[model samples]
Target: MSSSAAPILLLALAGFLIGGAYSTWKTLRWLSISLGACAVLAAAGAILWLR
Candidate 1:
């Protein structure tokens, strides 16, 4: 490949990786929230059952 094309290709790859990482981060954040909500509900149910 030509030198000029290499730089542009590398930059594009970097941008694509950054975008993928950001989306993964967002997905994890939502996943954690869902897990936390489930945990809280489970605890509440257990407390009520014990009472």
Candidate 2:
């Protein structure tokens, strides 16, 4: 894997983990929060990749 991709992947992973924790506490809204986190991570990664 390219070094540049590594940090983005790590950001995604961190977002996922944080989402998991967030969803766990607020069960009713878990999916939205988790998916939102993933989306945000992807967007951030894309922006960084473009730079």
Candidate 3:
């Protein structure tokens, strides 16, 4: 794998996690929040990885 691939995958994972959070918000508040937090961390990791 290339150096850039990891960050790119991280971003994609963040996107999926955000979507999962949104979809689960109505029925699973706690899970949604957890997924949102994870998404944020993934996004932050991606940004830091690029640096």
Which has the greatest TM-score? 3
lDDT of each: 0.54, 0.68, 0.99
- lDDT tens readout by residue for model 1, 2-40: 755554555455555445545656568765555555545
The TM-score, computed over Cα atoms with residue i paired to residue i, of candidate 3 is: 0.96
Taking all chains together, each candidate's TM-score versus the true structure is: 0.49, 0.48, 0.96
Q: Where is model 1 more than 4 Å wrong at Cα?
A: 28-51
| Candidate with better lDDT, 1 vs 2 | 2
Model 1 lDDT, full chain set: 0.54
Write model 3 residue lDDT over 1-51, tens digit each, in one string: 799899999999999999999999999999999999999999999999999
Two-way TM-score contest, 2 vs 3, winner: 3
By lDDT, rank the candidates, best first. Answer: 3, 2, 1
Clashing pairs in 2: none
lDDT of 2 by residue, 1-51 (tens): 997787677677667766665666566576766666776777677567757
